[model samples]
Target: MPHTLFIADLHLSAGRPDITAAFLRFMAEEAPKADALYVLGDLFEFSIGDDEQSPLNRRVASAFRDCGVPVFFIHGNRDFMVGRRFAREAGLTLLPEHQVIDLYGEPTLIMHGDTLCTDDAGYQRYRRITRLGWLQWLFLRLPLKKRLGIADGIRGKSAEAKQDKSITIMDVNQGEVARQMRKAGVRRLIHGHTHRPAIHRFDLHGQPVQRIVLGDWYTQGSVLVVTPETETLQGLSLGENR
Candidate 1:
């Protein structure tokens, strides 16, 4: 059956060779079989800039290009600093932060899913400030080493912040989800950020709706396979499903 694939939050880094190997395996073994692949967000642990394409980035780009599948990406919080140079190299198109698309006859909304966490005001504030064009312009002008240092510092602080927050506060707010669905006019929404993998079904304005959350690749791979006939959420084991 013809189908599309959705994945996100791989958080791939040179330090995490296991996840990188799993992703490469996936690109070689699974992604090529799909009609199209949508990478919703956070493909990298941190991206200082597209110009600073480390060996890992080059390898990932080669993998994506060699996979021979139409690939699309949405900016995640961690990779928002990434630019089009790598996208071109990877043979992938960059979509808007949130997009509505025709999903096998149904309208589906896709996003990186960070903005839905209305409760995390601090993170939301950080996102807003970091996404500013002028700020990014200045940041990108710095030396690559400086940029890397800044990125590392920010990543460390973010990890510290996460440890202080409760899980529920970090997750998506139901009201925000509903609002986004209504605004997008979609009955189905797919996103990945919080690393909670589940298909949530609920009533929206007396109609059935689904919010699909994709998991992170911290331990194993997560895939959301969708065809005209069915939607399946499966875990692609990295020899460590436990």
Candidate 2:
């Protein structure tokens, strides 16, 4: 039975050796078994630019190259700077912010899910600025040291902002999610960003729809497996590695 795997919010960095070890294990032991793999976003804690080619990034790229499956990556809020260079090195196909595809014969919409957090006006404004072509080009031209400093500053501010924000504002907005689903003409939506993993079934314009949220890999690994007849969310425990 052919099946597809979806994951997101790994936020992989050099500091988290435990998570990194788990991810390497996953690529070697689990991902190769899937027909295709979709990484919705935040694959890294922060990607200053593709040119850095840090040791950690190189390791991840090598792992992806050896995964033995078609891998696709969507830019997340944290790692939106992941460009073509990185994708090519990692042997991954880069996807747009929102992509609609036929999944086992069903129309499915996949995204990084940040755009759906409309209630967080501040974050949305930041997203708009960072996504601008001119601004991104200018940012990328800075020296590697400067780029890293800026990323660290921005990350610090983001951390502080989250402390002041309510959970509801950080999560996806229902209306925005529905609007995106309608635009994509999909009854099933798969996304990651909020880091809250759950299956949501609702009625949209009298039609039944479902939304699946993928969790972060901060504490454990979360994955969604979809086949012709079934869709399931499974968590891989870090304790198992002990």
Candidate 3:
């Protein structure tokens, strides 16, 4: 079984106990069944803790470490500070922003899609500063308590930023999507950031392609499963049947 997986927007935080349980269950059951797992972005609510010994982080990482498959992670706005330490501890491969790979014999591109928010100049500018190497280094050097405080402050600020942004500015622009699709020479674009889960079929240069938006895993469970024999995108809620 060739399984190329995609999940995003977990936003796992110490505040959400049920989500933590569900995620643990996922690793214990669901993850093992897959040949590979691609966590699109936002695996944590905000992880800047210096303690590699944190119980929560270690527990989550251990699940993947024992899953017996490849686990790939991409950085999202919330958990962008996830560093090499976490990756090494969790036994995950950190994927770059624009990663082109072959899955199931088809060319595919994976991203967090924050760059697609070209219309949101303010947010884009913020992304630039946070991603800066010097800024990250300075931020990480702070004490664990201070880092946690900073993470909390940033989270609150992000909520404010979202409130001020327009819907169109936040979502991916169609033209930009088309341009990237053409450039990558792959019709498939899979990402998760806007928390809108849908499988979009579009015609580009007379060729049909798919743009998959992965949903947030909070009250509902969603995953995009792509394999040679089975390819389907669906949402799973508590009351819904599988």
Candidate 4:
């Protein structure tokens, strides 16, 4: 069967070499067998810049280059800084924040999923400001060391803020989700960010619709497998599916 793969929130970094290794292993094994690979978002915990020359960054790019599959990446809140240079080097196709794709005949809306969390007023406000193109350009123009330091401060504050936010506030809002679906005219939505993985089935104006949330890579490798006949989310132990 021809199947496509979707993943998100791996948050890969030097500190998490185990996760990186697991992901690389997957790219070498499962990814090459897929029709294509879609990295929905947050491939990194925090991406400083495309100009970064870390071994961790290079290794990941190399894996994708060798995967033998067309790779697609959507900018996530954590890795919104991933630019064209890195995409070219990694042989990745960069996708917009909100994208609609034909998934084996289904019109699916794909996102990094942060925009669906309308309840998080603070994060939404921060998102709007930080994503300004000119602002990002200015920030990236700074020395890599400085950019990393600023990213650390921001990530630290984001972590602390999450500690204070209720689970409901951090998760996607049902109304916003419906609105997005309506706007996109899509009955199926797939995304990852909240680290909560599940299939949500609901009715949209008396019609059936589904939302698929991808899992984080903190514990197991999370993947959403889609084929002409089925859509399933699976968690993988480094080398095998469990």
Candidate 5:
């Protein structure tokens, strides 16, 4: 059976040795057999532009390339610095957020889900600033050591902010999700970011809509697997059943 696999919110960093190992194992053992693999985003804790690829990034990219299966990626807030050259080098295609693709004839839209952070005005402002093209270009030109230093500093600050926030303020806004679904003209939405994993079926404008959320690689792991007979999701841990 041909199967499509999806994962996200890994937040892999040079510092996070466990996650790096887990990710490599996934690529080597599982991903190659899939018909397609979609990395929704945040695979990296921080990507300091395209000019300097971290050792972890290089290894991960090589793994995907060697998988001999189609690999698609979309930038998340954390790794938005990923560019076209990196994608080409990794033998992966860059997928646009808010894109609709036919999945076994079912029209499905995919996103990183950060745009649903409409309720969090402050974070949205910060997102806009960091995503600027010129700013990213300037940052990419710096030395790798300097870039690493900056990324470390930024990660520390982000961790502190998350600790200070309430859960409600950090999650996606339901209203925004509905609006996006309507705009996309799709009844199915798949995204990763909130680290809350589940398949949600809801009523939208008198129609049935489904939203699938991919979880984090922190506690355990979550993957969406779609085949002809069934569309299933698996949540696995280090020693858990796959």
Candidate 6:
């Protein structure tokens, strides 16, 4: 059956070789068989800049290049620095934060899901600052070593901050989700970010809408497969290794 696959928050890095291996296996075994593959966001743990593609990034790009099916990427908060250079090298198309597309006869909206967490005011402010073109350009101009050091520092702080944040704040705001879906005129929405994978059904003025959250690859692998007839979330067990 022709179907599409959605994945997010793999957070692939040299530190997580097992997860990386699993992803490569996925590209080889699962992705190519699908009609199209949508990588919602955070494919890497951190991407300093496209100009700083490390050996691991090169390998990942090569893997995508070999995946036969069309691949699309949405920039997650963690890897928003991925630019045209990386996209070209990886053989993938980069989509905007919120995109609506026809999915098996239904209009579906896709996103990285960070913007929907509007309750996190501080994080939202940080996002805006970091995403400014001028700021990103300035950051990219720094020496590679400096850029990496800054990224590591920021990541550490973000991890610490998450430990203190309420779960509700970290997750998407229901109102925001509803607003976005309505704006896009889509009954189905797919995104990855919060790492809380679940299917949420909403009733909007006599219409039914579904929101699908993709899981993070921190401990196990998760993917959402959608065909015309069915949509399901499947997990890859890490077992004793995790």
User: Least lDDT summed over 10 consecutive residues: which range in candidate 2?
Assistant: 233-242
Score every model by TM-score: 0.97, 0.97, 0.93, 0.97, 0.94, 0.97
Give the clashing residue pairs of candidate 1, or none.
Answer: none
Query: Once model 5 is optimally superposed onto the true structure by TM-score, how far is the C-alpha of residue 8 displaced, in angstroms?
Result: 0.4
Q: Which pairs of residues have clashing backbones in candidate 5?
A: none
- Please, what are the lDDT tens digits per residue for candidate 2 over residues 1-242? 89999999999988787788888898999999999999999999999999988888998999999999999999999999999999999999999899998999999999999999999999999999999999999999999999999999999999999999999999999999989999999999999999999999999999999999999998899999999988899998765432
Q: What lDDT score belongs to each candidate, Candidate 1 first?
A: 0.93, 0.94, 0.83, 0.94, 0.86, 0.92
Q: List CA RMSD, all candidates.
A: 1.8, 1.2, 2.6, 2.0, 2.3, 1.5
Error of 3 at 8 (Å): 0.8
- Candidate 5 C-alpha lDDT tens digits along 59-164: 8879888988999998999999888888988999998867888888888899899988787788898899998889888888888899989998998898998998
Off by over 4 Å in 6: 238-242
* Candidate 1: segments with Cα more than 4 A from true spot: 240-242
> Model 1, 49-154: lDDT tens per residue?
8898689999899999999989999999999977799999998999999999888999999999999999999999999999999999999999999998998999
Flag regions of model 2 displaced more than 4 Å: 239-242
Candidate 4, residue 63: the lDDT equals 95
TM-score of candidate 2 relative to the true fold:
0.97
Error of 5 at 181 (Å): 0.6
- Count steric clashes of candidate 4: 0
lDDT of 2 at 58: 95
In angstroms, the error of model 6 at 39 is: 0.4
Give candidate 5 misplaced runs (Cα > 4 Å).
Answer: 239-242
At residue 11, give the lDDT of candidate 5: 90
2 or 5, greater by lDDT: 2
